[model samples]
Target: MFCGGYQVQGTIFLNPNCDPMMDAQLIGGALQGFGCDKDVLIDILTQRSSAQRIMIAEAYGSLYGRNLLEDLRENLDGHFKEVMVGLMYSPPAYDAHELWHAMKGAGTDENCLIDILASRTTSDIFQLKEVYLMQYGNNLDQDIYSETSGHFRDALINLAQGVREEGYADPGMAAQDAMVLWEACQRRTGEHKNMMQMMLCNKSHQQLWMVFQEFQNISGQDIATAIEECYDGYFQQLLLAIVSCVRDKPSYFAYRLYSAIHDFGFHNKTIIRTIVARSEIDLFTIRQRYKERYGKSLFHDLKNFASGHYEKALLAICASDGQDF
Candidate 1:
């Protein structure tokens, strides 16, 4: 089953039988009576399921008279802190936090915006909006409006509304939408921006995947290729993100991990966010896809890019067996 863009098989399922109170005690002990036991923090936080983590948080608060999140924040520093805290948040809250940060800076992080907003389902967006509001005290759509503009802004706004079509896809409608996409993108000298955005934003992922197939058959061009040819800048990026997410989100995120890790500059923020966000969702499948496509272990690459506590923490979460890497 698809949880928005993430596949169920892609998730890391651990802590099947767990004691949250015991976990809370252990975690509390790790944080106290030492100069912050990094190993214990890495092991416990990264091994447990997200649900278990929530329980641990509650137990930690009751047991220690301190919030688990605040204790982790004080004990850990740098990227290690980031990954641990990210794991503690519910999925929607995490996404909201990410979006808030993306738009908080002087210049908007278009890639972050596109990566998140375009790929999520209507239901995912609805949940995200609620969390975003609670976390940031601003509407998600209004934040988008403030941070972005033009066709790209419009697409983001449409996605933020969380009003996309859901349920079974119609083959006939898929074909018709494909033609509509082709005409909007390929035939005209100047692309029909409104029509393209409307259809792409409105259609369900199932329908969009079929539309992409029909588009490939009709235009002899993959949807991403066509979008690349017709549009430029953030608009093209968003369109490609939508198509990629619809067709294969794991592959899409796998490529993202590859780019972030392989580059000299090393998009650390993107790397940390992607791994932490997708850890419970599809990081395993992403790891498999990454290995298959790149002919290297993501774990090996991770070591090259990060080190010490940060590397240890990241590898712990990423390990297939939920062991420290």
Candidate 2:
């Protein structure tokens, strides 16, 4: 989730000898109350990794002869319900579901699309594309093509191809790529969108980091700043996301989390999706980055911005100290 294991410090981890039936009972006992044991629910759900949660779900269903996810939805409410259910899905499956939600809505969520596509690694994208096809019986590429248009659509298609060049980077080539990027944005204007997109999307993170540095050396402006000055609209946002992910993904997601739920009329769905999706990944680093940047705890902010089970669920996931709940 944060630069292909470049940042391995995360909030969630495998609980040793995690027993699924024990988890089932813990959850079952929690739900066996008049008011739904919110604390117990948060404790159980937030502490387990995704694999453990899946096993717990299976155990719960087998024990009670009821679908665990359905029961979760029936028992929980609002943004909390979405978070719990989203946590139940496997990572690739959950990402595919998020992409489907983004494109299926009345107006496409271009931010969600760009966020998922631009931030993911080549291998992750490959797995997500496969999951999307198997789960929905539709090609991810075709769905993206139909849902979007113009240079942004073309850029997304390139990303969905899952064809990034990986492994060691050539420094000389990185410098050349940087020069080409500078020329495209500065001298030639928007005449080389495809070249820029290909370089941004296809190169390995190590390669792009070099290219971005050289780009700044040559142009006297960061790649993101140059892209902002030269490009506009969805394409510019996509390019910026790519640059941000390559540079510092945890910080990027921290900022994204802030935007999703910070303002008046917050998007709780985005909050649920992002926090749930990232909980088992680099959410720990993201939380630290958020606190450093915003001068307050992410948990405190979520508690203020949201209410009821939703706030509790998010705090459980955020888990200020990055320890198991």
Best by TM-score: 1
Mind giving the per-residue lDDT tens digits that candidate 2 earns over 1-325?
A: 4354565456777878678999898888877667688787788878889999999999998888888888888888777778888988989999999999889858899998998998887888999999999989989999999999988998999999988887768998988999889878866344588888888888988899999889888878988989998889999999999999888888888888888876636887777877888877788888888889998878777877888877877877787345532
The collision pairs in model 2 are none
Residue range 10-72, candidate 1, lDDT tens digits: 345667766899888888888886588788777778888878899999999998788999888
Candidate 1 to truth, TM = 0.93
Error of 2 at 181 (Å): 0.6
Count of clashes in candidate 1:
0
Clash number for every model?
0, 0
For model 2, give the 10-residue run with minimal summed lDDT: 1-10
- Candidate 1 stretches with Cα past 4 Å from truth are 2-8, 187-191, 320-325
Question: Ten residues in a row with the worst lDDT in model 1?
Answer: 3-12
